[model samples]
Target: MGGAFLAAAVLARLGGRIGLPTIPLFILAGILLGPHTPGVVLLSDPHDLEMLSALGLVLLLFYLGLEFHIDDLKAGGRKMAVAGGTYLALNVGAGLGFGFALGWGTSEALVLAGVLGISSSAIVTKVLVDTGRLGNPETKPILGIIVVEDIFLALYLAALQPILSGADSLSAAVMDGGKAFGFLLLLALAARFGTRVVGKLFNTKDDELLVISFLGAAVFVAGVSEWFGVADAIGAFMVGLMLGSTSSGARILKLVHPLRDAFGAIFFFGFGLSIDPGDLPSVVWPVLAAVAVTLVMNVLAGLGAARVYGFGAGPAANIATTLLARGEFALILATMAAGAGLDERLSPFIAGYVLVLAVLGPLAAGRSAWLARVLPGGAGVCAGRGAGRGGGLTFRRRVRVRGGWSRSSPRPWVVVRLRAGGRFSRSSPRP
Candidate 1:
C-alpha cells in the first residue's frame, strides 16, 4: 500500500509535468498495482478504499461550489433549463436504448443509463479551468449546462440506490425525495447561519482546529444524510457549498486543497485498483460501446441545448463538444451499483469507462477553443456585445485611442499614447 501510494504520487506528478490529467495516471498506477497487473500488490481489495474515494468527491465538489453562487443556477434560468432538460432527456434515452439493445436486464439497463447519463463535472471543470477555457464565450453555456446536470445527478444518485436496490418502493422514493429537499433546506439555513458562527469560532490560527472543524462539519452532514438514506457525497458537497458561501470558504479551500488533492489522487488510483483483469475480456466490448454512446450522445445533447438557448451554431457546437466528458457521477453510479449487486457484471466496465473519459475529457476541453475558431463566425461571435467574452477592447476604446484619450479609464495617466499605426504605449508625465 505504501509503495503504491508513492508510485501513484510520482506518476501523477510526472503526468502533470507532461500536461496530462494526473487522474488517469493515478488510475493507471492503481491498475499497475492491482490484481490485473503482474508483480504488484498495493491494494488487496478495492472495496475497502471506496469510501475514502467518495470522501474525496465530497471535497472536490465542495471546492467547486466555492467558485460559483447557488443562485447562479437561477441566473441562467431559462437557457439552462432548456439545455439541461434536453441534455438529460437525450442521454437518459440513449442509455436505456443502448442498454436494452445490448440485452442488459431492466435493473441493469437503468443502471447503465443513469451511469452513462452523468458527466464528470469535476473532470470537465478541471480541464476548462486548467486550459483557461472557463472564460470563453462558449465555455459559459457548456458550464451552465453542467451545473444543471450536476444538480440532477445529485438527486438521481440519492434516489437511485433505493429504486435499483429493490430495497424500497415508490413510497420510499417519495420519502427519499422529501429527505433530499429537507436536507437542502437545512443546508441553506446552515449556509445562511451556521457558517458565520462556525467561521467566528474557528477564526483563530490553530491549523489543527480549523482542519478539525472543517472535517467535522463535513462528516457530520455526511453522516446525517446517510442516516436518511441519502448519498454521503451529496451531503458533503452541500456542506462545502454552504460553507463556501462564507468569507472563510477561501481560506478553507487553500488549507484543504493539498488534502483534497492527495485524497482525490488516491480516489482515482483506487478506482484503477478495483479493476479485475480476469473480467476484462467479457467487459471490454460493452464498456467501449457504453463509452462511445456516452461521449457522442453527451455532445449532441449539449449542442441541442446550445440551439435551444439561442447560441449561434459555432458556439453551440463548441459548448456541446466541450461538455462531452464524464467523471464523479459515473463513479457514484458504480458505487450504488456495487451495493445493489449490480457490480456482479458491470463494475469493471464502469471503472474502465471512467478512466477513458478522464483522459479524453481534458483533451476535448483543451481543444474546444481551436474547434470553436473553425466554426462559422466563431472568432467574431466571441467579440461583440452580449457574447460573454472577457477583456475585448470595444470600438469606443478605438475611437478614444484615435482621439488620444482612453475609452475604458478616465485617468489622464492611463490614456492612450499612440505612436505608430495602431500601436500604443503607456502614457507618462515628463518635462
Candidate 2:
C-alpha cells in the first residue's frame, strides 16, 4: 500500500512537471497498482477512498461557494439566469439524445444526461484563476455564468439521485423534489434569520468563534440536505449563498481556507486511488466518443447561451469555450452511478473523460482570445483594439496617478466655497 501511494505521488509530480494534469495521472496510477492492473492490488475496495473523495467534493464545493458572492449573482442578474438556463437545457438535451441513440436504459440515459448537463466548475474556475483571467473583463462574465450554473448543477444532481437510485417513482420523485424545495425554503428562512442572529451573536467579534460558527453553519446545512436526500454539495452551496449575503463571509472563508485546501488535495488524490486500471481497454472508445461530443457541444452551447445573454460574440465564445471541460462533477456522477447499480464499466470511462477535459479545457480556453479576435466580438471583447495590450494603456495610466493634490491646484469645489464665503479675500483668488 505504501509503495503504491509512493509510486502514485512520484508519477503525479512528474506528470505535473510535464504539463499533464496530475489528477488523471493519479487516477491512472491507482488503476495500474489496483487489483485490475498488472499483478498488484493496492486498493481492494473503493469505499474508504470514496469517503475521502466525498470529503474532497464537500470541501471543493464549500470553497467554490466561498469564492462566490451573492452580490456577483445579483449584479450579473439577467445574464446569469438566461445563460445558465439555456446552457443547462441544451446540454442535457444533447446528452439525452446521445444516450438514447446508444440504447441505454431510461434510468441510465437520464443519469448520463445529468452528467453531461454540467461542466467542471472546479476545472474552469481554476483555469481562469491560473491564467490570471479571473477578473478579466472577458472572464468575469463567464465566471458569473459558471457560478449560476454550479447552483443548477447542484439541483440537477439532487434530482438525479432519486431517479437513478430507483428509490423513487415519478410520484415519489415529485414528492422528493417537493421535499427538497421545502428544505431549501427552510434554509432560506434560516439564512434570513442568520442575517439578524449572526450580527447580534458575534457582536464582540472573536475570530475563532466566528470561524467555528461559519463552518458549523455550512456543515449543518450539508447534513440537513443529506438527511433530506438532497446532495451534500447542494447543502454546501446553500450555506455559501446564505453567508455570502451577510458581511462576514469573506472573513469566514479566509479562516477556513487552509483546512479546505488540505482536505481538497486528499480528495483529488483519493479519486485517483479508485480507478481500476484493468477496465480501461473495454470502455475506451465509448468514453472517448462521449468525452469528445460533450466537449464540443458544451462549448458551443455555452457560447450560444452567452450570446443570448447579450454578451458580444468574443466573450460569449470565450465563456462557452471555457465551460467545455469536466472535473469534480463527473466524479460525482460516477459515484452516483455506482450507488444506483449502473454498470461498473462506466466509472473508468467517466474518470478518463473527466481527466482529459481538465487538461485540455484550459489549453483550449487559453486560446479564447485568439478565438475572440477572429470572431469579431463573439467572445466578449469589452475593450477596443489594443485593449489586450496589457489591459490597454488607460488602466496603467490610472494606476500611475500620484497621491495628494498639488498646492497650486486647489480642489475643484474651492471656487464654490469661495463664492459662498462671498466677496474676496485677495489672498484666496476666486475662479
Candidate 3:
C-alpha cells in the first residue's frame, strides 16, 4: 500500500503536467499494476485494499459535506429550488431518454438515467479546489446543487432498488426509501442542533481525540447508512455536515485533510483494480458516445441552471465546467447493477465513460478562461480574491510600484499582489 501511494504521487505530478485529473492517473496507475495486467506489482490480497478504498469513499464524501452548512440549504431560497429542480429534470430526462433510445429495458434504462442524473460531488469538489474556484461567487450555488443531488440519490435509489432487485413488494421499496429520507432528516436536525453534542464528544485541544472521534463517527454513521439501505457515502457525509455546524469543525477539517487525501488516492486506485483492460476495446465506442452526450448535457444543464439563479457569464461557465466531472456515485451505481446481474456490458460502459469524463472534466474546469472567451461578455470575466476593502485582482496591467525612500516623490507606491490560477492573490487598487 505504501509503495502504491508513492507511485500515485509521482503519477499525480505527471497528470498535472499533462493537464489531467489526479484521480484518473491514480486509477490508471492501479490498472497498470493490478492483477489483470501482466505479472506486475499486484497486491497479494485485494480485499484489504478494497476496504481501504471504501474508507476513502467515506472520507471523500465526509470532506465534501464539511464544506457546507445545513443553514446554506435552508436559506437557499426559491432560486436554489428552481435551479436545482431544472438541473435535475434536464439531466434525468436526457439520461432516461437516451437509455430508452438505445433499446434498454425499464430497469436498465432507470439505472442508466440515475447514473447520468447526478454528477460526482467528490470529483466536482476536487475540481473546485484544483481550479481555485472554491471562493468564486458561483461556488455557493454549486455546493447547494450537490447537496440537493445527494438528497435525490436517496429518493431515487429507494424508488428504483426494488424494481431492479425484483424485491417482493412496493411497501418494501417504500420502507427502504423512508429509511433513507428519515436518515437524512435525522442528520439535518443534528446539523442544526448537534453542536453541543459534538463539543462534549470531541475536544478541540486534543488533536488525537479529535481525529479519532471524527473518523469513528464518520465510519460508524457510514456503516449505519448502508444498513439503512442508503449509500455509505451518505452516512459519512452526514457526520461531516453535522460537524461543519460546530465551532471546532474547521479544526477537525484541518486535522483530517492529510488522511482524506491519502485514503482518497487509494480509493481511486482500487477503482482501477476493478476495471479489465480486455473490456476497453469492446466498450470504446459506447464510452465515446456516452462521453459526447454527457459533455453536451452537462455544460448545458450547468449553464442553464446557473443562469436561472441570476448568475452572470463567468459564474455560469464555472458552474458548467464544475459539473462536468462524473465519478464515485456513477461507479457505485454501475457496481450495484453489475452485482445484481443487470448486464455485463453496462459495467464496462460506465467504467470507460467515467474514465473519460474524470479526465476531461478537470481539464476543462482548470482552463475555463478558454470557455469564457467564447461566451458573451465573458472576455472581462475575472475571479476576485477577498482582500482588505474588497479589492480584486485582474489581468489589466502590472506595475513595479516602489515603496519608500523616493526623494523625488514623497508618496510611495506598493506592490499589491501576484496572480495565481487566473485569479488574483489579493485585490489591489485599480491604477
lDDT of 3 by residue, 51-94 (tens): 89989889988987787667766787566767777778877887
TM-score of each model, paired residue for residue? 0.77, 0.74, 0.86
Q: What is the C-alpha lDDT of each candidate?
A: 0.65, 0.61, 0.74
Decide which is better by TM-score, 1 or 3.
Answer: 3
Q: Cα RMSD (Å) per model?
A: 6.8, 9.5, 6.6
Better of 2 and 3 by TM-score: 3
Error of 1 at 382 (Å): 11
Candidate 2 similarity to native, TM-score:
0.74
The residue-level lDDT of candidate 3 at 218 comes to 96
* TM-score winner: 3
- Runs in model 2 lying further than 4 Å from the true structure: 1-43, 137-168, 188-193, 199-207, 245-247, 335-345, 370-431
lDDT of 2 by residue, 1-431 (tens): 35555766788689768655444555566656565556666676666666555655665666666666556655677876777777777887877877776675777677778667777755664455444444444554666556556556545656776777666466666666677667766765665556556545543368878877767766777777878756676677667666655667667667767766545555555655655545667777877788778766766765676566555555555676678777666777888888878877667777766666655676666555555555644343433422221232111011112463244544332321111111212233333
- TM-score of model 3 relative to the true fold? 0.86
Residue pairs in collision within model 1: 120-326, 120-327
Candidate with top lDDT is: 3
Rank the candidate models, highest TM-score first. 3, 1, 2
